[model samples]
Target: MNIKTQLKNFYLLQCGQFVSQLGSKITSYGLILWTYDNSGSVLSIALLTICTLIPSILLSFLAGSISDKWDKKNIMIISDSIAAFFSLIVLILLITNSLKIEYIYIINFILGVVDAFQNPASEVAISLIISKENYIRVSGIRSLSNSCITIFYPILSTTIYAFAGLKLIIFIDLATFIFAVLTLIFLVKIPKRIYNTGDNTNILHQCKIGIKYIVNDKGILSLILFMAFVNLIASIYNCNLQPMILSRNGNNKFQLGIVTATIGIAGVIGSILVTIKKESKKKIPVILNIMMFSFSICNTLLGIGRNYYIWTIAVFLGNVLVPFLTANVEFIMRNKVPLEMQGVVFSARNTLQYISIPIGYLLGGVLADKVFEPNVYKISFLTNIVGSGKGAGIALIYIVIGIIGFLGCCIFKLNNDMRNLDN
Candidate 1:
């Protein structure tokens, strides 16, 4: 099929996925609120993130190979179905008032496993359906959708939770999942799957193919390593962001909603810019530069700011640059990775790039609760710098993470291998 016709189908698929994504985000935000309200621990929230990441990291090798061998559409449909089933379980637990922190962790881990298979299939499906020239544009649209979700979910969830509670959010999530699955089955059309006869049947060998592909390419390997390091720093910042806002804001959901909305608005603006601009030649450098500025500016403000106003500005500016960074990265991946190997390679990419995230989540929580928060007052000078408050330790952490992230980007920019990815 022609690119235009394929794009029409892609848009229909996106619309379905968009609804699903929004519902998922709403559920996520509601859970965060529920978790924090009940536990009042940063560690609790960080553990939630770790639960999701660890399963994906552990199952990534197998998931990628399976995705490559299986039908992408079926994989997606099955994955979504499994996820919906788990959401139902969560709803049942909540209704029974039996949902506990441990249960949440288990549910999240299962969802992560589902995502491990689903994400690579979804990525491969997009690559198959969309032409190469439109990679960046499509990435922008994806980013735009995610940003829109980010902008609204906090507000929606907060309002919904206040009025109706978490049960209603889960209902919306289930409804969206149904819509997405139906759209995939009925409305969307993916190109026929083309199997590579040369592909080995051994699952182990198939999994190794992706690893070997990256390892053999020093430039791509270095790029992935750089991202891994960046994720480490980002994970810390992310794990703490909600806790910091809530702790410092007296657990005001509206403040959190407003700040989160600003981030989405910034992302929308950034996505628009990426969609309209011509692709750049120096993608690696662009990625590194954007990361450096984003971490430096956003983290700094977040650390220093005591109010939602500053938080809004910090996130807005930081997120505005994210779409450009992601667009360039996706553009490079599409140009460099062969379509037949994309599923595995992309999975390998995820495993390597996100491996540090679990560690970051764990460390961020420990440091916030055990180390920083406890010692914030003892270290009078440090407390003076960041100011004494409920989230003082987390504030210090943001500053440190931002600096490390900035320096890490700078160091990676000096790597010749990363620069050569453009060639």
Candidate 2:
């Protein structure tokens, strides 16, 4: 198909993804708030995170394989259905005041299992069917969808929580899931993936092969590893922001919502830039170097930023580079991996990428609540002589991590193995 036609097809599916993400976000914060209200334990929150993420890490390869072996459209539709049904049950229980945190945990675990399949299927389908000229648009669409979640979720949840209560918001989220499933059913028609004629790998073998490929391919694996490391730090900063703000100036839930909306707005702006001008001229190393630097700077600023406005600005600018990095990484993975192997490869990559999130959250929770909270005064560096407890110590840590990210850029400059592929 021509580029225009491909763009049209890909965007239709993206709309469904957009709806899916919106509801997912609404349900997400509600659950988090519920946990805090019920137990007031960070450990409960951590368990919730582990429950949600463990499936993504373990089933990623398998999910990828199934997506490749089956009809891509059907995979999306089925996954959506699974998610919708689970949300509906939770919604009903919530409305009746029978919902428990355990219920939320169970449903989240199920959703994570489906997510493992849905992610690789949708991403690979875009690269498979869309013309290369329009891949940027696909990337833009994905980024925009994610941005919407960050942007609207806080406001939506708070508004719902105010008058209607959390129960009603769960119902709204259920509706979002249904809309997503119906959109997929009526609109998308993905092609079935076929293995190469000579390939004899079983499902188990296919899973292992993806890991082997990621490991053996030094260039791809290094890029993936570095991406994971950056993500780890980013997640930590995100999770700790609320505590840091609270510790510094007495944080409120309402203000946190606004902060999230700002971050989302920034990401959407970044996606627009990518749509207008995707990566074209620079080598991969150059792109990675810029992305890592930008992320490092953003995180460092967010860590140490005293004023709310400064943190908002830092997050906003941080997002601009994020889409740039995200689009290029997807571009690289799609182009380098074989069609038959795309599912498994992308899954393996996502598995590694997501592994950073739990680790990040753990680190953030620990530092903000325990390590930094008690010893904020003791951990102070000579440079932290002027700043507050949360501000200075956290800022010092961010500076250290930021320097680590920049050093990654320097290391990339020295590596020549991936230069030819990038060019």
Candidate 3:
């Protein structure tokens, strides 16, 4: 295909994915609202995230190999179909008033499993469709979709949930799922992978090849490790943000929604800049600098600010830098890795980078409940410094996370191996 034709195909695919993602996010937000309303425990929320992450991490190695060996389009369709089926199951349970919190956990786990295969396939498909030169711009456009979803889904879900109910929200999800599937089947065309006729490797061996590739590349290994640490801090920050705001605002979900919306707006702005701006030649510096600023500024503001206004500002600033960071990292990977190996290599990269997320979720939840929440009042200095309140302990945790994240950036910056990726 010509460049213009390829671009057209990718845009169509993005549109379909965008619609599907919006529906998924709507359901996700609705579920969070329901779960929090029922349990009122940070650990419960943490567990929900952990349930999803664990399966994705465990299955990633296999999923990557499968994506490389199988048809990417078929994999995505099957995954989406399975996810829709699960959503149907949830809907039935909700209608019958049998939907328990534990059931949601199960559903999330299944979705996570689907995502392991789906993600790698999707990444490789993008590589197939888009030329290398446009990787950064396309990444930014993808980020824009994500950001738009972030902004829209909360508003959409909250409204539907309030006026109609979770049933209606789920129904909308099903409709979007159908639209996405149809679009994929009819509107987009993904080029076939060019395989070597002599190469006959089992999926398991391909998985090893993926791992070996990363292990042998010191620059890629170090960069992935740095991201893993970043994920640790970022996950903790994400896990606590909702609960903290809810606690401080007397379970005012609107306040939380507003903060989230601000983040999306900022992300949209950032993504726009990333789309128009030239790709950075020094991607390592862009990645590291953005990480340092994001952690230092956003967390500190969130740690100190007691109201939604401050939360909005903090998230906005923090999220705006994220697209820049994300585009650079993606550019580095797409530029360095071969198209045929991306399915497996990207999957391996995900396994390493996201492995810490579950740990962060667990630690954040445990510390919030067992340690920080209980002891914030007792620490006179801490109480005096931040002022003890509903989310006082969580606030303290944010500051600590910020400090750790900044220090991580510094350490990564000094790594010769990671810096070499810039070349």
For each candidate in turn, the TM-score is 0.98, 0.89, 0.98
After superposition, the stretches of candidate 3 with alpha carbons farther than 4 Å from their true spots are 194-199
lDDT of 2 by residue, 1-423 (tens): 776676676777777778778877887777776776686554466557767777977899888877767777787788888887887787788768898888778888888888888888787777667766666677777887788778999878866776677778768877777777777778766555454212565667788888898888888887787678777767666665554554455545676677778889988887788888736765476567666767577767766677677777777777766777787777777778877777788888888878988888777666655655456576446345327654455555566566777776677666665565585
Model 2: lDDT of residue 316: 78
Give one clash count per candidate, in the order shown. Answer: 0, 0, 0
TM-score of 1: 0.98
lDDT of 1 at 356: 97
Error of 3 at 80 (Å): 0.5
* Candidate 3 lDDT, 1-423, residue by residue in tens: 888998899999999999999999999889988888899889899998899889999899899888887888999999999999999999999999999999999999999999998999898889889998778778999999999998988878877887898999999999999999999999999988643111588877887888999999999999899989999999999889999999988877778888988888989999999998876778899999998999999999999898999999999989998999888888888888877788778889999999999999999999999999899998789876566788999999999999999998998989999999987
State each model's CA lDDT, in order: 0.89, 0.72, 0.90
Ranking by lDDT: 3, 1, 2
Residue 377 displacement in candidate 2 (angstroms): 2.5
Answer with 1 or 2, whichever has the higher TM-score.
Answer: 1
